[model samples]
Each structure stands twice: as C-alpha cells, then as structure tokens.
Target: MPHSIKRIFTWIFWIFVLWAIFTSPNRAADLVLTIWEIILNGFNAIAVFFDRLLGG
Candidate 1:
C-alpha cells in the first residue's frame, strides 16, 4: 500500500481506538482483553499443531 494510505488508515484506527476508550473505558478494556486472548489461543493452537506434526 501507498505510504499516504497507510498513514491515513493508521490515524483512523487510532482515532477509533481513542473514541472507544473515552466512550467506555470498561468496554475498551474488555475488547482488548478479548483480542489478546484470541491471539494467544491462535498461537497456542499453531504450536500444538507443529508439535503433533513433529511427533513430539
């Protein structure tokens, strides 16, 4: 993607995040935690798959 487009998207994303945080701090925290757990679970699943594939 073009640098300008990337920058615009980044700014928009940050703006949304700030809006969410300011509108409802608790909801924002829960959203972040949920995202984090999803990412961690994905990583764990990948690791398990690799481990099983390698016969470990």
Candidate 2:
C-alpha cells in the first residue's frame, strides 16, 4: 500500500480501537482477556507437543 493509505488505515484503526475502549471499557477488557487466553492456550499446546516429542 501507499504510504498515505497506510497512514490513513492506521489512523482509522486506532480511532476505532479507542472508540471501543472508551465506549465500553468492560467489553473491551473482556475482548482482550479472551484473546490473551486464546494466545496462551495456543502456546501451552505447542509446549506440550514439544515436551512430548522430546520425551521430557
């Protein structure tokens, strides 16, 4: 993408994120928490697989 377009998208994304955060902080927190949990679970699963493969 062009530099100007990229900047516009970045600004728009941040604006939306900020709006969501301010409009409903609890909802935003829950969304972030859920995403974090999913990421952690994925990492945990990968670790378990590696441990099993290494016979640890």
Candidate 3:
C-alpha cells in the first residue's frame, strides 16, 4: 500500500468512526453527559492521531 493511500484510508476510517459514534442511539437515561464527554474524547484522540500524521 502507498503512503498517500494509507493516509486517505486512515482519514476515512476515523471520519466513519466519528460518524458512527455520533449517530448511535442516545442513552439519555443511562448517562446523559457522560456519553457526550466520551464521544468528545474519542474525537480528540482521532484529531491527535491525524495531527501527528500530518506533522502538526
């Protein structure tokens, strides 16, 4: 696999994961604020990964 192709796939995979997490059923009664906080943290991880890849 080429470097550019791998980068593209990585970006796509992270975007898909983020979308999936956001679109998942909201369990308000389970833990209202915690869910969003966790999701945000996951997004932050994704951002950090991409930042490192892109030489931020």
TM-score each candidate: 0.86, 0.90, 0.46
Q: List the residue pairs that clash in candidate 1.
A: none
In model 2, the runs with Cα more than 4 Å from the true position are none
Model 1 agreement with the true structure over 1-56: per-residue lDDT tens digits: 99999999999999999999999999999999999999999999999999999999
- lDDT agreement of model 1 with the native: 0.99
Per-model lDDT: 0.99, 0.99, 0.82
In model 2, pairs of residues that clash are none
Model 1 misplaced stretches (Cα beyond 4 Å): none
> How do the residues 1-56 of candidate 3 rate in per-residue lDDT, one tens digit apiece?
99999999999998976676677736433454788789999999999999999999
- Shift in Å, residue 56, candidate 2: 1.5
Q: Could you tell me which 10 consecutive residues in candidate 1 have the lowest summed lDDT?
A: 14-23
Report per-prediction Cα RMSD to one decimal. 1.1, 0.9, 11.9
lDDT of 2: 0.99
